[model samples]
Target: MWGRTARRRCPRGLRRGREALLVLLALLALAGLGSVLRARHGAGARAADPGPPRTPRLGRREPVLPRPPVPANALGARGEAVRLQLQGEELRLQEESVRLHQINIYLSDRISLHRRLPERWNPLCKEKKYDYDNLPRTSVIIAFYNEAWSTLLRTVYSVLETSPDILLEEVILVDDYSDREHLKERLANELSGLPKVRLIRANKREGLVRARLLGASAARGDVLTFLDCHCECHEGWLEPLLQRIHEEESAVVCPVIDVIDWNTFEYLGNSGEPQIGGFDWRLVFTWHTVPERERIRMRSPVDVIRSPTMAGGLFAVSKKYFEYLGSYDTGMEVWGGENLEFSFRIWQCGGVLETHPCSHVGHVFPKQAPYSRNKALANSVRAAEVWMDEFKELYYHRNPHARLEPFGDVTERKQLRAKLQCKDFKWFLETVYPELHVPEDRPGFFGMLQNQGLKDYCFDYNPPDENQIVGHQVILYVCHGMGHNQFFEYTSQKEIRYNTHQPEGCIAVEAGMDILIMHLCEETAPENQKFILQEDGSLFHEQSKKCVQAARKESSDSFVPLLRDCTNSDHQKWFFKERML
Candidate 1:
């Protein structure tokens, strides 16, 4: 050992080299052992503590929630959750929104499937079937004529908001030759992004009535819902209308209208509960409601109350029924009296007209009258005259102060009415809707006709054939004809007599007559000559016409022959009901 040690120390360079090599080998061995230990430790940890079970990846497949069965009573509380679920998806957060929407649709058809989903997910899903599928699909038809952009956008958004996505098949926008600079292009461009929106532009101006007819022709849905260009929709509007249609197949339904301030574009609350009132000969719309007592007596909201007529704007009906009713009277010149014509025909032709409380829409009432089209106004007046001929006597009876223009021919409506086998207006009042408070004389009540009896005869006398006979009976009053303006009072109990030549002479008729007529005499007629009938049926005259002749005729003919002569007179032959006074 001493000799070996001496040899190793003999070379210092050799000893240093050997020591370095040994150190290198030891470090390599230690590194290898450390790596092996780390591998073993990682495997042991993974095996000893199992991680939570991994959920199956859904991948590209859409998640579906089962559809719920349609409830028998859709309006009940049981269905409320489902409806909220469907509507709520519209506001979901971006990441989860697509999945939730798909789930909502699937659940709408299968509620049971939704019930099976995890309890945590129940609040996010809607599983009720709103049974609109049994009802006809509705096509919302809107006419745009230089409509304001904001108004149009609001209308579109409102419809989308209130209307159920499944029930709405299409929205038809008819452009009646609007001249607004950017309206056509902007409308088209914006609507391009929406599905089931159709834009139709007419090169020439087709009046409102005709334009609507054209839109209806193009519509594909089973039901037609007509909306004005300027309107905002309220919640639950579509459901009520759809329900009504389902209950009464032949019924025409209108939503309650709330007025909007045109200047501010703000909603002015509803005028009142919607009531249906007829027009006087002047074509003024009257507001009346179901008596409070009568409304309170009803047990359910489904009561079929009588409405004298419907407001032309925001009305709905089955497309088939609309077409069968002659579709807005092609003969009607334009927009004016078309609504009245539609109302009368629907009521008189075995169809029911109603206003639903659950539905509401807003319209802009003009602060000032539009003055651009004198011809259009005249045309509207002409249309009302042509279509509301039978009700003319009743109209004038209620509106004595109205100055009516002569009516032209209406052969088209007559032909259509005959083809549909429409029942007479009298039959409609007496049978199908006995609850309606229609007076015996519509014109007389409205102060339009000169005599209640004049509606029966075709006119045959005099120059200006249209004006030969006074339409309404003259009423004599104790005061100067100026006591009340000459037109008949709508709700007064006393008989009126013409005491002065003032244009304010009131028209008088029998208390129970179905129709009333008024004679609008020249403004300069003598006051003393005005005549009135007393409670005893005796004539009291200031002597405008021969009092002796009037008295003799009052007793012998009961004023029937004079009325017949006027009715037959060529002047009164062509009358229609104008909606605008």
Candidate 2:
């Protein structure tokens, strides 16, 4: 009986063990099914409404952060023109606007500092890819001298907003002895809340060139970018510049500078066609359409254009290369010819100067600069004396007074050129800048044109301002042989060009009207501007079949020039100052 009871107890224990095993297996199966259902539900949820993406494990994958999207609804977004009707007090403020910033500060203050710009680049640029991870970081230097509050901050915000945080080290604001009250503690306080920004105040009034050097000295990045205080940087503006500098350490790159309307504060995008920098005999920076040679060299529309010079207000260069090139000429005072000086140095000293179409920056082009321009002439003279070599004579011919201007000592600069063994200005002209028209290219009379009939009176032309060179009346005035307004260049092209600057004026005659006016010189040498200076010293108009004759205006005692029938009269006889010698 004990044996049978033991056997039954054993069976009962075994049965209980089997039941516990079955329960455990069933629980495992149920849990597995629940997990499958949860996974399927999760997948369905993701398909229906995916939440913010989960970043891959940090070390496992390096992710590219997308650029911050510009606010579409913000004011002045998409670079649309902002027009505001002004009356009463608002209209009165416009004068003050011009006096301060040379821009419509009223409108600038109203627009959002973080406003969006339209994608002005070619569609090809959108497809272009760059290795952002490997690109050099830049420290943007902005030098302001009593810059307006809104425009200055807007410039700062535009850079901070548009530039990749990883690529931008900092923005160094160099105050060039600003006396404005707002630019002191108030400006400091405003920038204090911003990250990656530094303010350096000069003890005395340092000019733009020195101020930029100050900022560059404080920079701690692979590249140094210089921007005007009143500028708006666009998307992708900094990348191509830094990329070019990364690829070619000797390359100094600039963006396609867009125009920001001064009167309206409207952001005007530049034409897709790039304009490279060139200078006239004046040694002043001027823009010209990219030559066919440069365009042919480009494999794509977005390729970098080899520019002879820069607009000087905006550019990026490797810090090491900049220092190696001796940086800016600290001897330069105020603002003027540094662009041409640096541009010449770069090419002559075995460096490349480029303008990248993929990069764009909007600049506020003022009606007139709100500062004294007395130093600009001196600055230009300095550049000519340093880098121009024998070519300096061309500049002196156009601007005779510049020879008398007291440009500071350039012995150190000359020594630097000798130290670097830089190529001569002739090489610069023949190789880097062949498009520049050297005045001596054609053999013709050039100087202050004096008329024999009018005695001491010369062909004096004074435009309303420098920019209004075209479509101005040429008048007769007392000949002052200082070689300014009376200067004229009778080119081999048979066009009497006003020798003031590039985009020089040509004396033109209307089809029916007898007026002799100064018009913008055309490349085609239009028949109307063609004139033949005869052996007898008469300016015969080729197109009108007439001669430029001096006549007294019935309205006043002043003599005015007009096209008249060709005659052997003394009134038709003219002589260039060089011919008289």
Candidate 3:
């Protein structure tokens, strides 16, 4: 040991060398650690901030979350500990957010319903002005069953804030026997303070059709506007819709519906021209890009465009005209086919259906429906029986299981149809919906490819892109009724086709193939081209004798169909519900 005076000190050079060596070792260790970190994180270089999420679209993937905040002085050991603590807090907040999202069903419902939406104006709307003073006062009737508090209240406020006081007569809220605590006396208490708002509760749970009828009967306004409980009215959403109805009482007009993101709650406006409502042969609702013919036919893009169907969520109609046309098929249960029934009835019963592009309203479309849909199936059968006529075979081809489903009495509806002397479905199809595909030749062998084991998963052929280009990998996807990709037509000749392009190609399979592919339907049938429709709903191959099945690999988020032995397994039992009729 050296004294403070350093009488017996070591060599200065040796001391300096030891100090330098220690510093060098520390530098080397830091460099090595930095290189390891770079190698690991270089592939996924993250941005400091990723801004807000994009608006959700129909059949599109969920948007990415915004970047979380980070501390600025996160350096050194103590700072590192503080950073970890902050990260943990963020994690807790994320968990709480997820819990709230799960309960609300839509992410936006977790936020304040009174929260402001971004202003998006349609160019056509800006250029035009409606006779707002002359437009009839509208009785906005909204119906709900167990709707979230924010979602329901937001719809009410959106209407109140957007609509002119003089133009809006009242907002009728029909609660279909909601069991939620928030919707009980608390809801009544809230509504009691709001002017021109009435809350009606059904003693028993009635379907939307009847619930709407109840609201309509109670309505005193000249025009009746029906909106879903989860909707946001834009600045001028009401004026144009009411103007169109005022122009023609027989016109059942709908506004341009903008989508409110189900996951992120971002409001997406009409970016392109606009989309009009259409239906497939199955009578399932669909959206199509405006045809050039329609553009030429209309006086202007802002002008009301004739539509063959309504989405059932939002529409404005003259109260007298609504009553004259038979308000709704009162027999329709819980909710499913009333929109199509109303659409068909409107067309066949001498009423015109149109969509007003100048008016825009945002609607929340959930990924999964909130309520039970078995009643919707029953309601669909009722519509087919009453209105579809001989064309109903096409519907049955798409939904074979619906034909035998117990749908309550439609005798009154049938009498109404006959009493009105409604045009035959043929004339309506030829005249009103000529663009719709007619599957008269389609036999009843094809439908949704539902797996017996995985009841939720279906054998879907819809390609990744909405466009069904040739050689697109056909995979299993969630079925939304005989939709574009969901359509399956199993021919009498034992060939399965999709989306009504029969004879173009049948669902082809080959021996020793792990996955199924859509090959061209040849005039001269190959061994792989042939298939056998078993009574058990399995598609058995003529060559391989294996049944068609969707893979049961751990996750159902995505998967493909596979070849397996025909057994009593539910996996093998599949329903080709949609046909190439």
Candidate 4:
């Protein structure tokens, strides 16, 4: 037994060698695991911070979140213009397109619902990053009335395709009681399969303001994103907006609105200096070049551009903050002055209104507005009465008809202003929009320019249409006493400005013709636009060396203003509304 035990115990060296082999295997496993962990850490770091900025590839596909596949060869893909050879039935389709949505709806139908848009973002925006995980989720609210099937659905699909699923809480489509066939059950069925999409219908026509309010009421997200029914969102548009709102809850941000040609459906991105919102004394929204102050404040091209007012169709705001600011004026009938009202409220009520250059949205700007109802005048009146304070006189001075408009009771809005302890409109003009040209500043000879000869006749400068504002013929019509079309201001600069709106036109001699026309006012007060209202009431044109005379046109019974040799005739003599008073 002792000999057998000694033989078994003699294998101690071999057992030690086996134990050493096990230790070596254990060390190798640990090394492999450490390499894997290090690789994962590197991948995560790459995702979070894409190393020091390289030259941004303008349209580079940076799919941090899974995105919809781009149909590279599809029609209207890459935001290219789609034109159809007008022949046979195609012409009728084009006509139908015009009649329907005032856009090329026929071509819109042919485009893929998930069509890819060209990356029209600035290089700085492309290089910008946002914390996606922590950003607030938004409920996209799109309000529509008689919207086309393709355009509305394309808007929906574009958002879904571009927005990260986790960040998009839901999409609420508020149909403003559209009577169209497709908008009823077809819209619902089409949206049924789409996750996080809801369609709510108004029992009666609620108009845009109320329709959006309905959508906001039903939203269950941290932020409310309002988009027009005919918009194509670019990739990464949502993140920057959410990030801005996340950083400052009171910030209401808008995307850089690119133009989608209504006729050709081509996407036009403005990579140049961005335009900010401004308004004239008439309370109409106008786009102005970014002021030097605002430009200086923007450290990068991707920074937010402060605006006096928003274009209004597309913007994002924190849900809680929006509600606190009263969302929108419920009394506003339709879509006219809502943007300005919201803009004024935002600035006066301790909120930030900004345009994020990092986010881009392409909107179809129709050549002419399809809707006939222009409650804008009434809506503007309400806003002026409620918020404009003493500055409301500036709006009223240019728009005397607004005084008669039965703008619904603004008591509630006034109460809201008082409740919010909002700053007066004076602060808004002086602090926020000092670049705006205030006619009252250089109040010289303003109001209806009445002809001393033709009793009750005044210089009426009505554009044949909204598009014909520049270089339109000025005519003499019966003075309406209303300040709109007849509103003329003989500026201290010796220019007779047709002061209806911004970029105010000056009474100038038509090239090679003695006819009086409205030309864009030049800064130099050139000889053509220069007019001297003599003490005798004669409007002497400096360049033409003639006086403006009311001449009866040979073709029609109507009279037109013409430049002729200076005379003592009563027709050449004019009196301003201020003088008449």
Candidate 5:
């Protein structure tokens, strides 16, 4: 009975234990199922409950940092200080290896950004149009004077070959009295068939200055371009000049002048790069290269630069401004000095001159000068003297060896100045165009007389009062005490001697010296005072006391006449100093 009771209890205990284990297992399974259901539900909620797409936390947002305030003056001291500070910090940061590694990473990221960005926004890419139709229209004027037939024909053909038809309007050839008969007959016969080509011949010689003026007067186009009779037009030559003129009405444009060897008739090309022609105080032409900074800054070849002066051989200008500036100083003598005169006047009177790189022409440099009916050298010298009078002192300073006595007449120039009411050279320098480089005032002695121990002393004197001399004058002095040989000896002995001894005058001063004063006249007799010096070292009665003193002094070798107190007398009377050729 006891064994049976024990067995029953054990069985009951075992059943209870099994029931508890089953309950624990069921709870574990329910917990697992609930976790799976919650995970699925969370995923469903994430998919269905989206209002706005959430940015990934990895790369979407960056922490904000305040930017430095901009300085009031971008290029001022404050801005410069800020820039220096930043640069210093950057240098400091770059010095550390770890920081440099981080910078490398950042730079790699920046490079990736650049690669992925749109090409249209990229700054480094260049877009250019290769077509010629987009260029501006140009009218070319060729002035011929006994030009070689082959060369003239080649020039026309070269124009046709190089210049686009749309850009070219008219090629007017102004014949300035060509001696060659075939040039007229053949040029008409050959070029007449071409479009927009016309020839105008002057029965008499009009020279280069007037010839160009005549052609320009007849120009129907907005821009008037001048070219020599013998020239080879380069590729894409016309557009640059026309483009510049279109942009600026007052722009005077020139082409790159390459040298054509006269002996070989071959194009020497350029030495290396384009050079703008310049001028000296003497009104002589020179050439120098364009600066590199200028090349980088200019958007096109049309940009204006500080040209020393225009090339004058090939240039284009607007018709309106040309007329307004009175069209090339009509009073200028023949060809030579006209270009310089025109250049100085244009620059001084408000005009910008530039040499365009895009336009190029080859000029034939002659081994010998071409024959001219109008004494070309003398005519040029005359023009230079008349137009560049103010600059003469500076010129003689630089070229001390040059002989400059025989230039041209200024009578016509005087007439023009009166007619135009033109401003004085000083006014032109200070007001009309201050940017132009006018040479500084230089005062010195020049010529053979200065070398012979005689001082050609002349000082530029401003009037004490408002009254100043306008033209020029020379005071003639006849020293009654000395002859020519004695005068020469005295001048040789003394450091300062009178330059002129031919009984005519003192150095030529500007026209304002009016009051005549005689000083230290030994002669008291009125009839004896007025005398003339004979060739055989003698004196004869003339009229004035000053004349007598001059003649008597010229006759003797021992006496030296001194100029003293300013007075109005026959001895101080001045005559116009005429320059002998």
Candidate 6:
């Protein structure tokens, strides 16, 4: 229900090559976090306030990257000697460990937010100049939960430096109750100089979902652009997205996300091809290659590609349409299923979602999310209940115990759906996302293994204990409720395979051996590898004639399972329940 508008730049003394905006951009950007820290540290000794916070001149001068401050507990002399002794492998591991701790980013946040990246415009886009003078004004919202200071400020810098101020209304920063000492009032004070930047602090911990909703409520722009706290907006990123929306107001547009290497802080732009979003039956979103049909129809790389789903971190939506379409499921607790729900809602509610290949933004995809996933599961359930219709069974089939998980009240969401008169999930599947593999929802037992007797512990294949060799002992650790390491799938092939992305490996043992080992599953498992799940929920190995039981020596605390004679003991009694991702 929207149309494209071809506009040109405003006549107001706007300089070429983004030069005229440097002075204004400098004032509107935060002082380096390193500068702020040094000022605070020298406050007792220095006479006056650190002479007018360090200003960032976006286009006028190159910005210097900041280094991480050495920890107070650092071991000095002995550490240096240990490093020398390490020579090779030990040193590598130590460096890798330190890097991993900072969410697998560079040894430090050393990249300038305003640093120029390779221009990613297709020839079609670069050759055509549009009138952006009347494009919809946008408000970029970023919500963070205990994020690193430098990275957060850099994200803000990237936007101001790359975007034309006329189209950008403001940038809203929402702190989701971060406990970091430096992220306190100081962060607000530092950001105060940036006229276009507004900082909001939460009184209590609200996860990313609620925090973003709060940000959206405070936004005043015609379009709301959501950027992750660690992203860098490349040159010309904003124009294409807004231009697409200008063409069609109801169209939700997202940038082609480039990779910012987790370890090297390198910028990896598009590989000259486009990608789309998809999800598995588990409701987990993943990036996949564009389908062959889509490639054949929209042959040009520059053509706008309609996406079935979003990867959840970044996108721009029309403020009016976002509200009319139902902003977000407030009942959804945290950040897991919101993107998928929004994608389905957009397609089902008569709006279209597209990814503009011309827009490029670099996002830091952390190896693991920082928050607890318990709420994510609850959130996914809410989406399934409100919008999935009968198709929700596929989700439940993958996460069987989700039926027992409690999601908050969905009556309001369901009513909202009815009020909007949205299309069903089936229509979305048949039309928008036919490539998604639908699960059969066949009933069976799968997930985490729990020892009925030792309720305090669960079966864990954690490293050193289980990652060592074929016969490495698996231990029982206190239940963490996260099945990431403990999850297993009981296949029709009669093999117990770990429920990771690639679950080709299964639990098995040799004919005469009592020790269980992780091995690649065969189409037809041998008698020793086969296991029968009795109606009583106990596994009986046909070859060994014994029940898999967790047995501990009297003198040791080690609770490792083994092939013990069937005594029907509590240790031998086990049950399977789905684990939250």
Candidate 2 has which clashing residue pairs, if any?
Answer: none
lDDT of 2 by residue, 1-581 (tens): 11112131222344578689999999977877655666667755323333588764222111112234557765576778877788999978877877777788888887777777777887777777777667888899999999989999989988887887778889999999999999999999999888789999999998999999999999998999999999988787888898888767678899999998887777888648878999878777888888999889998899999999988889999897798788999988889888999999988877778999999999998778888778888888988898999999888877777888999899999998877778899999999998766775244488777788888888889988775688878899987766757878888899888866767788988768888788888777999999999999998988888888989988899998888888888999998774233
Candidate 1 lDDT over residue span 527-565, tens digit each: 432444333322333332211111113455432212221
lDDT of 6 by residue, 416-485 (tens): 7777677889888888888764433234556577888877667777445322324444567776655556
Candidate 3 regions exceeding 4 Å error are 1-110, 440-496, 500-516, 519-581
Candidate scoring better on TM-score of 3 and 6: 3
TM accuracy, model 3: 0.67
User: Model 4: C-alpha RMSD to truth?
Assistant: 16.2
RMSD of each: 29.7, 18.8, 28.0, 16.2, 34.0, 16.3
lDDT of 1 at 399: 38
Q: Please give the CA lDDT of all the candidate structures.
A: 0.51, 0.82, 0.71, 0.82, 0.48, 0.72
Query: Which of candidates 4 and 6 reaches a greater TM-score?
Result: 4
Compute each candidate's TM-score over C-alphas.
0.54, 0.82, 0.67, 0.82, 0.49, 0.64
Assess the local accuracy of residue 218 in candidate 1 as a C-alpha lDDT between 0 and 100.
95
Off by over 4 Å in 5: 1-136, 291-304, 373-389, 395-581
Residue pairs of candidate 6 with colliding backbone atoms = 3-247, 4-247, 7-131, 7-132, 8-131
lDDT of candidate 1 at residue 372, scale 0 to 100: 41
| C-alpha lDDT of residue 233 in model 4 | 91
User: For residues 1-581, could you state the per-residue lDDT of candidate 4 as single tens digits?
Assistant: 11111122222344477689999999977877655666667755323323486653222133323446667877878889888788879889878878867888888888877777777778777777766667788899999999889899889888887887768888999999888898888889999988789999999988899999999999999999999999999888899999988877778899999999998888887766678888877887888888899889888877899999999889999888788788899888977999999999988887778998888999998756768658888989988998988878767768877877999898889888888778888888898988766665245488888888888888888887654578788889988877878888888888888767887788888668988888888777887888899999999988878888988988898888888889899999997874234
Superposition error at 243 for model 3 (Å):
0.7
Greater-TM-score candidate between 1 and 4: 4
lDDT (C-alpha) at residue 61 in model 3: 15
